[model samples]
Target: MTQPGFLFTGTPLELTDGEAYHLRKYWKKGRQAHSIQSLAAFDVDVDLDALRTLVQLDCANCHLAHVASCCEGGFPFPPAAELLPVLDEHLDGIAALLPLDVIRHLLRKGLYERHLETAGHRTIGTFDGNCNFCIVEKNGPACMAHRYALQSDLNPMSVKPLSCLLYPLDLIYSEEDGRTLLTALTERTAAFSRWGPDYRLDYLCANVELRENLASADSPNIRENLPPDVFAPDSYRPAYVEGRQLLTELYGAPFYDELHTLIQGGRRP
Candidate 1:
């Protein structure tokens, strides 16, 4: 099965039968394993182990500190089919939120026309190393489209690219067994073929040790050189806990419920 083009560019990791089995074994640990196994009867499958390992990230901190942002990494324009609904329904709202210059450029360049010309697959334009739609803010860069959607009382996902929404957490479809796998970037997954780029090394959000080291540093230079509260461990939380809304939105409440049940040792309120 041919995978649909995503905003981000990366070869999807295809797991061999043996590799798949091993990955499953790696997941079958502790009480969570029982819940992971139970998911086979559900509509979606998850990489609970990988998700559990991702402890914390402060996106605002990362952006304010001028760290490498996924937005700055040029990504493809989501296929026209994926964008048409938004443009058809909310184009005016989006245009209203963007700077006049950007709107003028889009009009001159034929924003909708470009989607058709590129056959729904082309690199999105960038300015100053960030996505052109990004508005620079004192706190951080924000997507104008997303902001517009929120202001209009619309779902941000309706306008935001799926790739942008599902960062860190990767949804992989396997041709080998015809299964859809949900996983994330972890040390083990980074070593193996996994979705998205291996960002476990330097990205503060992905590296726990780096965050800890930065958080605890006492050197005068170290203290002065970095952003205030950069990589603060206090901001950290389990990936599952942090990603509750996204997970529920993507996989439905039952899927997230099962995950929560397993993580909380079957405790329910």
Candidate 2:
């Protein structure tokens, strides 16, 4: 079994020989047989199992009530080489959109050069378990870059980091298969030792049971403080549908259409 290279830098669970073997076997059978040729100039193989899983992403609830799990623990960032283009093209615009402190940090750190110092793939800076670009208000944390994109009438993903935009949907390069695998953390994948930070599926957004439990839990803090609507079971939707915008932005409409078709058990359009 081969160790797959993650597209972004983050600590992945190391697999033992037996675990790796089982993972490879499962992956071979579970992933789409053909790669979807993405507009990003890469072929992506979607995990059919992961795509079909139901999920609910209440980002505000995660930030205000629970921990912002995705924002911490060395959250993935693109390599410096890849980041250079983003910086060159959008750094000024992003800085203008963000707060003064964030802009100051960017200037002080020298962006691409700073990433190179941290082994070519440095995680984005976080303060108080939230992303630097995250503006924490009474409502919850909001991404400055995303707000900028929306205000500017551009796709939110256009200004945000690829890894940030994708969230639970991961893109990993399979060295053995020579193609990128697009997957999400689901119960079946979570059970395997080869696939995670181990807590990827523990969040309210990722786990339907957690959301349901939290919604109906008899805790005063939950009922009095937390937002009830965010954890409602009705808020849950299939991962494919919830992630449609980011997926289409990253891979193109055709890629999403093909994935939707595959998930629906229909021939690719």
Best by the TM-score measure: 2
Count of clashing residue pairs in every prediction: 0, 0
Off by over 4 Å in 1: 1-49, 55-57, 76-84, 112-123, 127-129, 191-198, 215-231, 264-269
Question: Which residue pairs of candidate 1 clash?
Answer: none
**CA displacement after TM-score superposition, residue 141 of candidate 2 (Å):** 4.4
Q: Please write out the lDDT profile of model 2 over residues 1-269, one tens digit for every residue.
A: 63553333222223445545555665666534542333233344344447656677666566565544445443335433454465456667666767777677767765432244245445456544455666655443366666667678987656666656665565655555555556666766554422353444345666666556665534332332445676677877777789998878766889788777766667664
Runs with alpha carbons beyond 4 Å of true place in candidate 2: 1-23, 29-49, 67-69, 72-76, 97-99, 112-120, 126-130, 191-202, 215-226
Clashing pairs in 2: none
- TM agreement with the true structure for every prediction: 0.68, 0.71
- Highest-lDDT candidate: 2
Q: How close is candidate 2 to the true structure, as a TM-score?
A: 0.71
lDDT (Cα, tens digit) per residue for candidate 1, span 1-269:
65332222122224444555545554444226443433542212234446665555555555554445545554334533444555456667777877887777767754532334234444345544556577666443367776777677877667765656565665555443444455567666553223323455546565555556665533222222455467666766666767777778767898788777756666545
